[model samples]
Target: MVKHGISLVEAARRLGVSQSTLYIALQKGQIPTFRRDGRTVVSSGALRDYQTGKRPPCAYRL
Candidate 1:
């Protein structure tokens, strides 16, 4: 069967960011994610939106 989403590591690689940075973004709600087959994954569309600025990054609060 084909996968609907990509692994977190792949997502980080595509975004050219470290896994820790991606994790922080996930925690801050900057990036959305879901669990599939017991593993966390991110949708390609969402990643594209983020890259294109369609999904603006969340503001950091002090």
Candidate 2:
């Protein structure tokens, strides 16, 4: 079955950013996340929105 969400690490890789950078974004709420099986994951659609500049601009630069 295809996964609907991706791990933070995988998300970082797909975004071409470091995990620390992704964590920073998470902290700032720039990226949305959800708990799945006690682990944090981001939905594919959300990631796509972020990549497409659909998310609001972050106050802190990444």
Candidate 3:
């Protein structure tokens, strides 16, 4: 169980990927994200929603 609103790095960690990999996916739009105070972020709610089929699966390969 993860808390809501975590950093991109932590999101990558939870998904078992390197920060660089996540960044690459982000750059390619293979992953979802939002800006917060000018910082890249991945909300846990989004992740959870994704897991529950709320969002499409990422084409990113780690």
Candidate 4:
């Protein structure tokens, strides 16, 4: 599996949600993310934090 990070599309795929829904959530600032190499990259760290109960509730359920 990809370990370092993932693109928004791939992240959505991994989360079993539609890519467009992920995009909409991102635009609404409802997901945790960051930028890398000029591309918006979802933070693996934040995903972990979310999994471990360290983040606010988000509706995506990813």
Candidate 5:
């Protein structure tokens, strides 16, 4: 997972969203992420999964 990890900012940029928005998605379990060096990071595969619709938004349904 280390090799596939990227900083949250970079991931946000790649996804064309703000860091805070991405962070919220991470916190909501809408995105796959893990802590690295005490900071949250996202995997390239996770990003791909998101783009491919393998991951879904976690907004409240009720």
Candidate 6:
């Protein structure tokens, strides 16, 4: 059974990225996540928004 939210591995697979890459994205705040039951969770809406380009990638202003 699928959980309320998706695991980082699943999200990475859907995004065609590696788990570590997703982890880095999480750490860098490129992708949003929240804690649920002591595990990091990403919402489907957020994933969809990312896929559809509704959310921009993290940019560093120097």
User: What are the per-model numbers of colliding residue pairs?
Assistant: 0, 0, 0, 0, 0, 0
What Cα-based lDDT does every candidate model obtain?
0.83, 0.85, 0.70, 0.70, 0.80, 0.79
Which of candidates 2 and 5 reaches a greater TM-score? Answer: 2
Ordered list by TM-score, greatest first: 2, 1, 5, 6, 4, 3
What TM value does model 5 have?
A: 0.73
Query: What RMSD does each model have against the real structure?
Result: 3.0, 3.5, 5.4, 5.7, 2.9, 4.0
Error of 4 at 14 (Å): 0.8
Error of 5 at 16 (Å): 0.4
Q: Candidate 5: where are CA atoms >4 Å away? A: 56-62
The alpha-carbon deviation from the true structure for residue 2 of candidate 5, after best TM-score superposition, in angstroms, is 4.8
Best by lDDT: 2
Q: How does each model score on TM-score?
A: 0.78, 0.79, 0.59, 0.62, 0.73, 0.72
Overall local distance difference test of candidate 2: 0.85
How does candidate 2 fare on TM-score? Answer: 0.79
User: Which candidate comes out best when scored by TM-score?
Assistant: 2
Off by over 4 Å in 2: 1-3, 56-62
Model 4 steric clash pairs: none
What is candidate 1's local distance difference test score?
0.83
Worst lDDT 10-window in candidate 6: 53-62
Q: Taking the tens digit of each residue's C-alpha lDDT, what string does model 1 give over 1-62?
A: 66589999999999999999888877777778878899989999888887887765667632
Cα displacement (angstroms), candidate 5, residue 39, comes to 2.7
* Tens-digit lDDT string for candidate 3 (1-62): 53346798788888788888777766655557877777778877666764565665565554
Writing each residue's lDDT as its tens digit, candidate 4 over 1-62 gives: 44456888888877678999877766655667876778888876765564465765665533
